[model samples]
Target chain A: MHEWTIADNLVRLVGEAARKEGLTEVSEVYVKVGVLRQVIPETLKTAFSHLIGEIEFAGAELKIEKIPLAVKCRDCGSKKAGDDLAFTCGRCGGIDLEILAGDELYLDYLEGKGNGE
Target chain B: MKIAIKEDILKEEDRIGAENRREFLARGVAAFNLIGSPGSGKTSLIEAAYRELGGELAIGVIEGDLASDKDTVRLRNLGLPALQINTGRGCHLSPLMIKKALPEIDLAALDILIIENVGNLVCPVSFDLGETAKIGLISVAEGDDKPTKYPLLFREAEVVVLNKIDLVPHSDFDREAFYSGLRAINPAIGVIEISCRTGEGVEEWGSWLRERVSSPAGR
Candidate 1:
């Protein structure tokens, strides 16, 4: 839903990192997105592509790592993928659960070369 | 070379949210984020609360919608301080919007600030607006399957308000199923049944709200 805002922040962060490292080009930006974010990958890529130029990273590509939903059963202490958005424990059939993942939206790294020409 | 830049995507928004929280705390203002589906009686609930508890508490509202000042007008007609934010096509209200709207409100004069979020259950839950409490509304007309379908919103909210209880007899709403579904998602969530039209259970809701506003836990 807010892919544009996420993309804008991604560009700002990558630009900041590039500036700090004295890099002229950011070839790729790796991001980890959890399932709960509900961000469309194509929309995020488009937003990133549109804004990358303003941050002086014209040819940078956005790489997204889709993280599946993972939850832990509070009763049995078993962890598994939360399929169908049920979130209930698979083994114990318990409603008491703790979410271990699937809400993350963060920038992992940027791959590029320093000014060496 | 790989340069590690592990940063949350909503870092900027969170920063703004923290600022808003600090401001609210400093002013001793109890802020609430009111979220619900479209036509789920969010405005009606606010109006009902104001009618019942206006003498005891001064309420201000920040109304968010896709593209209308209609709700803002409705609140202002009651002589209450209200600010309308038209997001155009945006799905949710961000912390920046709250930060900007703070200047329009006299934080010192207000005891409670209700930020009525844009109508949508899914997108609004993800964005934190630095509210003291997150209250969700579900009308009986919306069906009891809402909690099952949108578990995240139900799970995250501190209070789930079941509005339009006055029409329960006319509709096909299964109250037991609704409660069961909500309990499945959140065992301790406070569900207050109220009808803005009939004023049923509005006093109980008001008392619960006043307790939150006066208590340190809500801060």
Candidate 2:
């Protein structure tokens, strides 16, 4: 599954962040996943746990924040957060819409014990 | 202690993709990533393009499949410079794969490079392979609801190639519904309907390729 691929990237990013922060043990990792990405939270969590099990951040809590799809209509200039995949403007019935968010996949922050703590 | 690290998970991949873009620009090669579902006529469209524009443009291909080099062999049989990447269990082709394949091809000798991604809609759309444009291919047999079902692919693709148009009459494929779905996701996406088997719209597809190769913008 693509979850494995995403988890691999997440591990690398987390490792790099840990190194920069001098974290000997990471306790929690916060990530933002967009709804448009179609990523299953449960699957991603499983993948993340599987990948981090043997690392220094083995027991780190993977916290995921799902971001809803937000778009701005070019015709009516209306901003809307949509749950469905219609992708149409809610107010103006326009198809020309600019995506404002919800396509993101990123690590927001992390909490951990650093060196000499 | 808390460490603030707001970073895109695919930052490294994007960085490599940017490097690939620069390399393509330096070589003056218009590269296009062709993505579609299995049995959506991706290989056939490549063959059709080879037949139509092979003589006019120096076209090279990079075929990405799970475990076979059948597509690479097919293109090689036609005497096209082709390379194949077997992703094994990977569902999509990553920028790293593209980076490795780049050295195998003589970039300076080609005007166009077409990377045929693994036959997957969801995973491949998220990964950029440093191509000039991403082409989403859907056939009439796949139903008109594809754009709505897989919005990201349609939203990200520069153009959507509707292949197997000859089967439109045989199947109950609604063209208006398809266009409406595409419009909702990507209003400005260029659409070219073609039947590779019958060569119905190969000329238009070839012209689109030619324009992309000739234009400095490579839109």
Candidate 3:
């Protein structure tokens, strides 16, 4: 499994998002990581830990939201979670399907000390 | 009343990366971050390319690997200016690493600098390397589902090379699925199928590389 390196890169991304949202003191970061990505959560945590000191997400919690792979059948228009890359239409048994979910890896929202809600 | 410098770190990093790229371009050096899965022929392609075009082009390489200088040694054996970065246990190369490694090499002398990123399909795509292009290598032996399954690399790549095509006669890779998936996700991306070993489609790849980097308005 591959983990995003440069340790500081993820920290910077989380820190920037926090600043823009004014959730300067992020208590938690909600990241949506796709299953297809070989991102190891633990390694990301380790990278984040080393990097958080340089930015606003310092001491901030990292919350990972794992997104499973989902596909929408182009043949029959049925939306379903992909099964082992079968990615076939559930209703019509057609093999042509378009991926609808599970390619995402980004910061979504923050639970923070200053979340304006 | 805020005492903290509340910031999204990625944005800050990207800001720095942009500046670095600007400086690099100003110096007339174009960089490319080459990424792919292990055994996808990332290094071999670079060696093949240098042997064919190195004399005409002043090429320099930065090799990223988990713990060995084996790949870097290969590049050096070719007599190309090579820098080996031993990442110990790290999985991918990031902009910061490039920025750190840039000073070691004479960035001003080369027309192109190729960064052979750690061999992985996913992690390497997320990081920016202050490069003009991100070329992803996918071999036929890895199956055609790679583009669809690993969408991030596919989406990030400016050009995708389906390497080792000569072996397709013996493999079960679905070519149609590969093309369709890439087209659906990234219509603007240029696709080239080549056998790095037999030199089957390298002329096209080299031509494509030269074309993109030499385009009048290219950055």
Q: What tens digits encode model 2's per-residue C-alpha lDDT throughout A1-117?
A: 677888889988898789877899999999999988878889889999999886778988899999999999889999988677667787978888888889889999999998799
DockQ for every prediction shown: 0.57, 0.73, 0.17
Highest TM-score, which number?
2
Candidate 1, CAPRI quality class derived from DockQ: medium
Q: Write one digit per residue (lDDT tens) for candidate 2, span B112-185.
A: 99999999888998887889999999999999999998998998888899999999889999999999889877
Model 2 residue A85 CA deviation (Å) reads 3.0
Candidate 2 stretches with Cα past 4 Å from truth are A115-117, B216-219
* Count of backbone clashes, every candidate in sequence: 0, 0, 11
**Is candidate 1 or 2 superior in lDDT?**
2
Off by over 4 Å in 3: A1-61, A64-117, B1-9, B216-219
Candidate models: Cα lDDT each:
0.87, 0.89, 0.75
Displacement of the residue B138 alpha carbon in candidate 2, Å: 0.9
- Which structure among the candidates has the greatest lDDT? 2
Q: What is the overall TM-score of model 3 with all chains considered together?
A: 0.73
Better of 1 and 3 by TM-score: 1
List A-chain TM-scores for all predictions.
Answer: 0.93, 0.94, 0.74
Interface RMSD of each: 2.1, 1.6, 7.5
Q: Write the per-residue lDDT of candidate 3 for residues A1-117, one digit (tens) a residue.
A: 344443354566666656775674767666777766556789878767666766756787666777787988776788878424444465886666677877676666666765554
**What is the clash count of model 3?**
11
